[model samples]
Target: MKKKSVGIIAEYNPFHNGHLYQIEESVKATGAEVVIAAMSGNFVQRGVPAIADKWQRAEAAVRSGVDIVIEIPTVFACNSAHNFAEAGVEILENLGADFISFGSESGNIEELKGIARVIEENSEYIENFISKKTKDGWSYPRARRAAVESITGASAASLLDSPNNILAIEYIGKISNALPVTIMRTGPGYNEFETTEKFASATAIRSLINENEDISHFMPEEAKNIFLKSEPVDKDVYFRLICHKVLSADSTDMEKAPAGGEGLANKLKASIRMCSNLEELSESLKSKRYTRTRIDRFICQTLLGIDREKKTDNYIRVLGLSSNGREYIREVKKSETCRLPIITNINKDIKNFKGIGYGISVDILAADIYNIAAGKDLYRFSEYLRRPFCE
Candidate 1:
């Protein structure tokens, strides 16, 4: 009998017990024999640096039962929700995944499906939404939620407010349009701050780690060990790099950065000199039209030199894979549907791939540079981190 496979798009900054539960539930729901995770690299969707590198995170996923881990290029990894969803969906499709699973606050798929339909159709509500936002100076997300509430009379305001629900809706929208994969929903909110009755947020776990608090209660034993053994790069270093780029780079160069638009370049250039840290710069630059996350992503893009218009997923950068994952890759290798080459090493040739984005390349380079600056040779140590499925 053939085994079933499901793909999970994630950034396992530190794979916790909740993540383990989600993986278990996804497998149970989908009856998938294999779980392929398209995970974010050194950065995450919220524009903050990931606590762990891709390889370490991938190892955690594998240890927790993920069959294979593919890299969601940093360009998409650090962008807005919609693009992140699109990129993840595209990668799953390329891998010929049969289903995609994600966590959500509103586990009601029908509600998400309805919202997806509204967004897809570009319904009259969206136009009214834009108009209302233009008048009230609301952020895009806030305006969209307000419009949905007004047009549907369904009290979608609460659903729209939850970050996990927002991403879940985007995932549904992405799958609804072209992908043939089924969807599996999980419990818990992505941004939940406190330990809930059954689930805790990744954000809370990271906060605990940042404050040198005990996270063993939240994370798996293996995950806690990984986090303890590995030291995270200084957040200040990356922030300073971003600030320097913003202050020194020409407007034209900054304009080409990912999420750079609508005079954001000038705003960032002006704000970088005034603010001292990433959080302060974000606060200074955030406007009613652009959210803090969006500005943070733009700063990351500027640091990585990502050109938004030129972004593409041209390679399947494998972070880790289990035995089952290796088998799946072997099966897919024979199919014409898998277009991008699987890349394991960065120093090797990749320039032949056309759709490879500047952001992705720069991100890889930056990670290497980050490793070197911190006095650790990442290239040498990166391979040791990669383990076989069984460890």
Candidate 2:
């Protein structure tokens, strides 16, 4: 009999104790022998730069119990939640994963499933609920929750409001349209900043790290070590890039930027002159239909110069996988179902793979430019630091 495999999509930013708990619980709950993790590279899905390099984070996942680690192509890694979830689901489906394990605020699989069912069915109650809420000028998420509550009662509304729960629903949305992978969720809100005995949000940890404050109370010992060893690029570096793009590019050109649409380019063109930072630029662009996160993703797309229509999963870039991960790859090599090639080295030429080549090149260029802007040699350092799964 073949060994069962589960997939996890993560940023691991530092891979703290909370992450470890999720890994352990995933294995216990799914009873899978192998776990394939699709993680972000130097940048995360949230459009923020990661503190640690990708290889180190992958190594940490392997040490913690993951069997395989694949890179979530940079194009998807630094986009909106919907795109992020779509890219992850695409990789898991191609990998022939049996299940996807994630951490959610609700933690109650039944409640998440209930929400997923409503989304999948697109019931009249949900539709009317969404329409009414949108007419009132509420954001889609807030409105959707209100709609769910109107039909399913307050409990459902409360569950959908949690940040992690929203992500869980998105994950389900992607999975429903893409693959047959089962979902196993564990844990509390990803936005919770306060430290609990077992749960702490990545946002809080990142904020503490950014402020140079004590994070020992929130992270696992291994994660703490990794975080200390890593040096993250300053946020101001990205801010300046955004400003440059806004100042130099014409309104028409800004419209060409990823996710820039519907008079947003002109708005950004005008707003850039008025706003001093990325946060403010995002705020200035936001409206009833466009949320802060959506605006952030657009800015990130402009920074990376990714063409939204061209996004696709063409190859599997290996960040760092353990010996076990390598063995799994070797086993899957014989299966025709696994169509995408595993990229072991960055220098190798893969001309035939259009999407993969574009994704990798874009990421390398972004890292290179970001480093130059910051007066650091991140590209050169990344080449030396990056290692293969078995290495």
Candidate 3:
């Protein structure tokens, strides 16, 4: 039998104690010798810039015990939960992982799989059910829950209440090849604002950082050091760019956006004149038909020149890898298991990776936006300028 490696799909927006715990526990639970992570780039699933750049975030994972770190496409990174989870699992599977590991409120893998089964078996009916609820002015998550409850019953549907459980369900639903292992989540839940010494949510850490409060206790020493050197993207500066994009561009041209810029694009443009900040902009544009996350993703696509029209996830980009990580990739390459080429630097390797021209093009473009947003430049933001952090 082939060696068993566990893959983790995460943002690691700032790798904290909780992330470290998940990694340690995953290794113990599955006896997987190698741990590979498919992480988001500059943008995250929430439709916001990551607290730290991809380099720092990826490096943090390496220092904390991840064997290999690969970048998920920016378009998928800044998309909806389903899109994000699908691409993440795809990349990990492509990397030849034997099993995927995740932290969830309900550590029972069977329960999450049960919900996944209900959705997969009744996909057509569930889609119709969600569509009906959406037409009636319910949010996607709300509509999805109603549909899930109909199939899985209210007891199972309640599992979707926690953020990790919802993502765990998505992972279970998306993975086609690898088995999934759920590591019990310890401490506060997702977006939990206050943190104890032993546990703090990524949301709480970012909030604390914004307040200039010390979070040394919550983050790994190495991750915190890298985080301190980098500056977080300012919402006002980027929102200024987003606001202008909404105002100057023809609403008719929004078909490239995720929701087809007709109603939602017009809503953003209509509300553009009154909004003052990113928070207000997101709030004003949110409706039953389009959500805040969808609106934020639209803005991300609009600015980065990404559209639903050309969504091709054809390559896995390496951000950072430890020594064992290098060994793992070599084995995967020799085995010829991954369908898509793995690239270290897009500018240098795009030519080598066939049929991924568009994917690389957007990957480069997104870094440019991230550089401008984070107030970094060619010194740090340029993809070709930095070497892979192989320790």
Per-model TM against the reference: 0.89, 0.86, 0.96
Model 2: per-residue Cα lDDT over 274-368, one tens digit each:
87777788888788877777677677777777776665655687766667677777777667677677777666645545556678777676667
lDDT of 3 at 351: 72
RMSD of each: 3.1, 3.4, 1.6
Cα lDDT for residue 344, model 1? 62
| Candidate 3: tens digits of C-alpha lDDT, residues 1-391 | 3467999999998899999999999999889989999998888887788999888898989998988998888877777778889989999999888899999999999999999888899999999998888878887889999899987788999998888999999999999899999998998888788788767999998898899889899999998888888778878888887877777787767657664554777777778889888888888877777777777777777777677877575578999999888988888988988987899766678777667777777777777777877777756658768767887
Local lDDT at 361 for model 1 = 62
Give the least accurate 10-residue stretch of model 2, judged by summed lDDT.
176-185
Residue-by-residue lDDT tens digits, candidate 1, 355-385:
6646456666656645643446675655333
lDDT of each: 0.74, 0.72, 0.84
Best TM-score among the predictions, by candidate number: 3
Better of 2 and 3 by lDDT: 3
- For model 2 the TM-score comes to 0.86
Compared with the true structure, model 3 gives a TM-score of: 0.96
Provide the lDDT at 360 for model 1.
51
